[model samples]
Target chain A: MQRPLDVLGSSTDKRIIIKTKSGDSIFGILKAFDSHINIWLDEASIDGEKEVKLGKVLIRGDSIVYISPEK
Target chain B: MQRPLDVLGSSTDKRIIIKTKSGDSIFGILKAFDSHINIWLDEASIDGEKEVKLGKVLIRGDSIVYISPEK
Candidate 1:
């Protein structure tokens, strides 16, 4: 069995797509999760410059629009 | 055992407060979480009104601002 913390911690090197209520989408890799459920998102870019750290965001489970596996 | 999906699903009746990267705060009950990680937030109010559905939002782990337990 897996836990919510495990799911939050399991997003390493995995390409995740997040859709916002404002109708926005963000694609990146899950870096870390804290007690607040704050997420560290590393955006995917083609420039290969570096991981664009999206900082931290408070996300309620119900506010989630969709989550899917990346190609 | 717990999973991320479980975490996403476990927010029922929980008073969750979300902080956005834009320096915005939203408080509500977690209604649901879909495959896209989109969360449906039910905002809290004192007017005795119904829950304000915030629809869905995409939140990267890193973009999290903060989340704390309500008093």
Candidate 2:
């Protein structure tokens, strides 16, 4: 079985949703991440629909709830 | 052998640490929970030291990172 990080890494360039404790999620192309799980997203949206104008965004690892790949 | 919820239920009255998405944790006596995994803790503390006067507290399931039994 692939490790969790490996699975997360596989989602790179794929549209994924990064859920946070706030009950909200960021949907974007997974760009980069580190051991801490902090992420960088390109052309991200809030909840996969509401587009955020920001070209790229950085999310703190500690604030992460979970990361799910969009089908 | 016990399931996750069962194991959590067994931790009732025992001091446990409920880690959250923020990388912070709630330490307290596990008192109650539901199928959703939302939890209630008694005499809870933040990070197991700084006491929060609140006697009981509720934690949203989605915000949970993990729970650990404290020795």
Candidate 3:
């Protein structure tokens, strides 16, 4: 019974990666999502910053080139 | 003190709404966001479903037409 929201909600504590249309990749833990499709990504490199907000993004599931979850 | 991710994360418990590029609107509570920009929106009017997941969506901040939080 895996729901789509589950994917977004449970992504916390997991290493998630997102590839944008520009071919740039953003890697971080699942933070939060709102109606605006705004994303809160805690990037990997910044030390102890907790989370960095990526403002709003245009993410069509189709445009998502890649997604890798750390095991 | 308001970070972008904060917007996504705190949207929960609030009556949040999202406007899509197609000129359609989706209303719900903020659930989660991952690197892919995928959104977990708890749409309105779904009766006791708690939350529903909208697969990955293309949401450019600019494309987001409007957002109204319940007062």
Question: Which candidate number maximizes TM-score?
Answer: 2
Better of 1 and 3 by DockQ: 3
Least well predicted 10-residue stretch by lDDT in candidate 2 chain A? A1-10
Candidate 2 local lDDT, residue B13 = 72
Number of residue pairs clashing in candidate 2, backbone atoms closer than 3 angstroms, sequence gap of 3 or more or interchain: 0
For all predicted structures, in order, the TM-scores are 0.34, 0.49, 0.36
Q: Candidate 2 on B1-71: residue-level lDDT in tens? A: 76877877677779888888666567777766666566666676565234434345555566787888898
Off by over 4 Å in 2: A48-51, B1-71
Report the CAPRI category for model 1.
incorrect
Q: What's the true lDDT of residue A70 in model 2?
A: 62
- Off-target runs (Cα >4 Å) in candidate 1 are A1-71, B45-71
Name the candidate that leads on DockQ.
3
Off by over 4 Å in 3: A35-37, A45-66, B1-60, B63-71
Tens digit per residue, CA lDDT, model 1, B1-71: 33334444445667655545454555767666455454455554321234444544444433333333233
Tens digits of per-residue lDDT, candidate 3, A1-71, equal 88554565666556677764444465666455444334444433211224333333223344345555666
DockQ, all models: 0.07, 0.06, 0.07
Q: Write the per-residue lDDT of candidate 1 for residues A1-71, one digit (tens) a residue.
A: 87756754555668766665444455667655455443444443211133333332334443356544466
**Native contacts recovered by model 1:** 0.07
